[model samples]
Target: AQSVTQPDARVTVSEGASLQLRCKYSYSGTPYLFWYVQYPRQGLQLLLKYYSGDPVVQGVNGFEAEFIKSNSSFHLRKASVHWSDSAVYFCAVTGATGGNNKLTFGQGTVLSVIP
Candidate 1:
């Protein structure tokens, strides 16, 4: 079974500042990774995903994530953050089968971007 852990429960950043959200996964072999964001009163939106190929993948908006197998981490990074980016971020992982049938999610990290 695979699991994800988000060290930071909450993060605050000033508008226009760079942001990085840490995510660590526990799995024996390569697993599917995903980052999802939830805005106020909205469903979870897919920010980025990693299955194979390039270690670094670009996502919606200015969000990007890098898969570092050695560190068992898939951290999310944004060159610049906007006030609207404030939301709850979740890191999830699934087995080789793919799909959400056996997905495991982290506790989630709340991001607050101040103007």
Candidate 2:
């Protein structure tokens, strides 16, 4: 079994500011992590993911995430954010067991970009 926690319910940042969304997970053995963003009235889009290798993975929109297995964390980061970046971000973990890839999600963090 696995779980995810996003400590922040909401986050606000200036249009050009950088962003970091925290995520923590609980799982035994190897864990697969992902970051997904949902815009207003839009479906969820995969932002980034980590399963193995490099530990750091690139994502769309200049976003990236690093998997720190020892810390059980996979935090999402952006060098600079635009107003369009405002959305609800979710952290998810998928475990493959018995040929089943089950995903567990976080509560989500709503981001607000101010002009």
Candidate 3:
């Protein structure tokens, strides 16, 4: 079955620290992966995505993700952490079977930034 998996349920970090959020996906054809961040009381915002060709895609707010086809994974990364960056990050996948454009999100990873 095709699905998106986020192994980590929560991630904790201090201000000015670096962070890494992992994501894995399964699909029949070339996968389209995405990373979104949501604040405490707001909707999800696009952080990064992977389509084709380039394995690594850059996103907003100094965020970036790498799509490794061999491992069927799309991992998100940040150079430095900030208090504002603290939020729930989600990994999603599209382009599943039957031409479903709807994105399938993982359980989600909550990030807590300690100042």
Candidate 4:
């Protein structure tokens, strides 16, 4: 079985500050990891993804994440955040069964950026 865990239920940050969100996963085989962001009343947009190769993956809006195989972690980071960045972030993983690419999402971390 494949699953994801997001420790933080919500995170608040001031505008122009940096941010980081934690994520962990458990899977039987090689997993495909991804981060998605959703704004108010909108669908989720892909932030970044990691299938293979580099451990670090860059995302839009100055977001990035580093994949740690040993720790089974893929944490998201941003150097500077804007007020528009305030939204909900979800960490997801896909199994290697080679069937439907259904994503298992975490509980989600709500980011509140204060101006």
Worst 10 residues of 3 by lDDT: 94-103
Ranking by TM-score: 4, 2, 1, 3
Whichever of 1 and 2 has more lDDT, that candidate is 1
**Candidate 2 structure, TM-score to reference:** 0.95
Identify the leading candidate in terms of TM-score. 4
lDDT of 3 by residue, 1-115 (tens): 5699999999999999989999989888867789999998899988887778788899999998998888988999999999999899999998834675888899999999999
How does model 3 fare in lDDT? 0.89
> Which pairs of residues collide in candidate 4?
none
Q: Taking the candidates one at a time, how many backbone clashes does each contain? A: 0, 0, 0, 0
Per-residue lDDT over 1-115 for candidate 4, one digit per residue giving the tens place of the 0 to 100 score? 7889999999999999999999999987898999999999999999999988999999888999999999999999999999999999999999766959999999999999999
- 3 or 4, greater by TM-score: 4
In candidate 3, which residue ranges exceed 4 Å CA deviation? 96-98
List ranges where model 4 is wrong by over 4 Å: none
- The superposed Cα distance between candidate 3 and the true structure at residue 12, in angstroms, equals 0.3
Which prediction has the highest lDDT against the true structure?
Answer: 4
lDDT of 3 at 59: 97
- On lDDT, the stronger of 2 and 4 is 4
| lDDT of the structure predicted as candidate 2 | 0.91
TM, every model:
0.95, 0.95, 0.94, 0.96
